[model samples]
Target: MPGFSFETAERTHVGCVRKLNEDRVLSRPEVGLWAVADGMGGHQAGDLASSMIVDALSSIELLGTGYAFLDEVQESVQRVNRTLVSHARLSRPGTVIGSTLVALLIYDGHFACLWAGDSRVYLLRDGRLNQITRDHSMVQELIDSGALQRADAPYYGRSNVITRAVGVNDRLALDIASGPIQEGDVFLLCSDGLTGMMDDDEIEAVLKARTADDAADHLLKVTLDRGAKDNVSLVLVHVEPSVDDTLRTARRTLLA
Candidate 1:
């Protein structure tokens, strides 16, 4: 399979109130791996947990078909989960040290999104935005079960309470979704810091109006402007036509 090339950008901020930024972002376009990890154990441990997650993923070297690559990505995440769990038990027993993970893997015109927390993966195609990953948070559960209305989620005070996260437990359950990539599709991977500050509509507008590079910066700026209470991080990817397709079009234009 011919590999699909992409335009990618990422950003992270400490926010106005936080003394330290616990959020970590990885943009390895060479391996087509991008991720955002938001740590949750305060200053000392939160940064450590998030950085560990990014380090583990960055060390992965996948050289196979798309599905095989996806498998390796999942395995890598699970391996890090176990490692973090053990480290926490030995170093800081009874203290929670975990991070929320959301990752995107693109290969051979195929893309896979894997996540474990409120951090999200969104696909913007044909001017419409679709969320590819669901939030494993307490408020999401309430909205799903009809206890809380979707419109009222922003007002909920406990929106930060996530039900699942990486390194939080011995057995980590990640949600994975895969699909074929389309030309002109834009994939947005972000931490809750962005979502907590802006609604879906506001996010969509920014994504629609800006290029991937500009979009990442603008999103972070907007979040900070709105009082980013927590660490903010995001990865933006713009999918383009394959090399073969672009060359073919050029050839036809030459003949014409």
Candidate 2:
């Protein structure tokens, strides 16, 4: 990934029903970091929680790559977690302000996905679409436990319940997954607002678009068309070899 470059597109929509769009997206390809955070709707100051996450991640300065970069990201998220928890303690007894975080980090030739709650990171490679980050929602737990069928997940009554989040607990337990990055691989980071409106197949069809901008526009359009009931947000990143890297690859091929 060091020799490659990325093209990214991001979109946030309030949807048709929500009065406020409590979703935040960060796209910093320069730093090889991108994220999406969905504020828990109906909770106190959901928008504020999401914005704080974006601001925290924006402050990250890449001192090094790999685990060092990951450490910086994790610490920033944890710092925000502490802030939100302290603020809630000073507020009313039932006040809870939190947001789900899903961040994609690329460095060297590897990629890392860090997440808490249901925000997702997906990968599209070799014409196959794969969900890289697993959801921490009640519906997903039910499916995993065999208490609910995967097909019934959409209709599950407690679909909004999330087990892990950035600020709900004093010690935030973030989940991480890492793998090598492949040229031509495409990554998608999104809030549940987008997923709640569209299915994986519908998303795959949209991702098939030729450009990141087109894919983002078309995806948001479809969400609105389907009567989006929650705030929707997404960031699409396309990986391509840099010109110098491409020439080097070509030279290697010729030599071979």
Candidate 3:
């Protein structure tokens, strides 16, 4: 398995309506870890919960390659979940402090997507964009059960309600998906704040037209323009073949 290099960019905004931003974005390209956490529970608690998630992730040290690296990422997220639960019990009692998490980990030509709640991970490859994670929200459940149409989701009063999130329970159940890495692969990890305001097609269009940093900026601007009712956060990652690998291939070709 060959290692790759990543180009990453991230942004988080308080939004027009919210007085406080409870969303947190993590961009640790050196360690191949990136995530977006959207907090829920009110100003102080929500901000605390989201910050706890990113802080725990930022502390993760790469122990080994491949699966070992992925293990560390998962463990770190779970560790934070427990810490948040404990904190709520001891300090906030009866009030839930939780955050939705969506993370991307790439190592040794493999990529893993882990998430809970509505925050999402999207991949753009060969000019097509695909969503990698499903939302664990009330509206999603309704749509899955054929009780509600996807078009009407935004109009539902409880559309913002999530069914699963870190720190909301004693144990966190994250959905993990993995696949082989591809050069020119672009990944977008974002809080529901961005998705809630813009549909998948609109997001895909912006990502297709700009570089990682520009896409992130454009997405935030569009969200704000469209009435960003919630805090918006996003991380954009672009994977490419390592310079050493490319050089080696060129040298081999010249000799042959």
Give the winner by TM-score.
Answer: 1
The backbone clash count of each candidate, in order, is: 0, 0, 0
Q: TM-score for every candidate vs. truth? A: 0.95, 0.94, 0.94
Q: What's the true lDDT of residue 65 in model 1?
A: 88
How many pairs of residues collide in model 1?
0
Tens-digit lDDT track for model 2 on 124-229?
A: 9987889999999888888998999999888888888999998888999999999999888899999888888889988887887668999999989988999998
lDDT of 3 by residue, 138-248 (tens): 999999999999999889999888999999898788999999889999999998889889998998899889999899899999999998999999999999888798899
TM-score between model 1 and native:
0.95
Better of 1 and 3 by TM-score: 1
Residue 12 in model 2: lDDT: 94
Model 2 stretches astray by more than 4 angstroms: 41-44, 247-256
* Candidate 3 clashing pairs, residues 3+ apart or interchain: none
Q: Model-by-model lDDT, in order?
A: 0.89, 0.90, 0.90
Error of 2 at 215 (Å): 0.2
